[model samples]
Target: MARRKFTREQMIAAARDIALHRGAGRVTLEAVAEVIGSTKGAVLHTFPNKLTLLEELLRSMCQEWDRRFDEIQSKTTGDALSAYIETWEQSDPQAPSYLEAVAVARAEDPKLLEPVRQAYQRYGNLMQLDGPIATDALVAWMACEGLVLLDLLGLHRFDQTTKDAFFSRLKAIAAAHNGEGT
Candidate 1:
């Protein structure tokens, strides 16, 4: 009988699907192997441990965010704050699993979140380029982060109208800080 072959990307994709559908806590080497129709050894070949797998998943998520940020920043004429706000606004708020990667990484090992922290730091540097308005941009970015955290934790009490209004205000603040008016 021929052994099933699974690529590293296939294992990561399986892990991501499990994390997104079942929950990050449910993502394990065995789960990923099963999802990919391969043995645990195959997954282990690429991801030595579950923590490594989760870290890779988290890193990949951050990379995707960076890609989106670049695309949006270009469209916004290099307005980092506006790009950040638009990226958050455009993401699916209902899909809390996107943030679940952070929770999983923290649970496994706080240091595993280095990729996430690095991504944020990169964005923070860009926000600082606004010079005098950097403070306002930082404030807007902080607000967006807080809102996302609240939503991810299911602690937000905002109705659809309130959520829309909040995001509208966030966009207004970003625009104002970027010198595009409210």
Candidate 2:
């Protein structure tokens, strides 16, 4: 049988998976290769080393997140703010812990910091909520990030009452912005 032909994107995703679950420093060329049943040579065909691999993964993740927000914005144009809130709450399990590696990259390599900032910028522009609603939107995103991090790090869990309270606050803020009563 011939070796499987994995794209650069595939390798990057595998690297992200390894980094998110195992830890940031664990994203070696050999580890990603094993995840995809490839070889270090194959991974290096796309990335020169672990740093290059991590950089590619971070860039792709950021760009993909931006694209997702764009899609949500277009899909629910009439209620983009609501759509954004829902998407924010429903982010993937891998995302929160994924930030762990990205944060490490901030200090270890210069390339990592920009993607996080860019991703947030894209999300904000797509949200298109103004004034107070924008502030609430930021709060919602921050809360979701906190929830995910807490869960991933085994630190804390947001009880149902707390989660409900957050949703209530966010929805109330959005409702008020839309000229409705929450």
Instruction: Kindly provide the TM-score of model 1 when superposed on the true structure, using C-alpha atoms.
Output: 0.85
* Model 2 misplaced regions, further than 4 Å: 77-81, 95-101, 125-138, 159-165
| Candidate 1 overall lDDT versus native | 0.78
The digit string of per-residue lDDT tens for model 1 on 88-110 reads 87777533333566876776678
Indicate the worst ten consecutive residues by lDDT in candidate 1: 92-101
> For this target, which candidate reaches the highest TM-score against the unseen true structure?
1
Q: For each candidate, what TM-score against the reference?
A: 0.85, 0.75
Best by lDDT: 1
Q: Among all windows of ten consecutive residues in candidate 2, which has the lowest summed lDDT? A: 95-104
Clashing pairs in 2: none
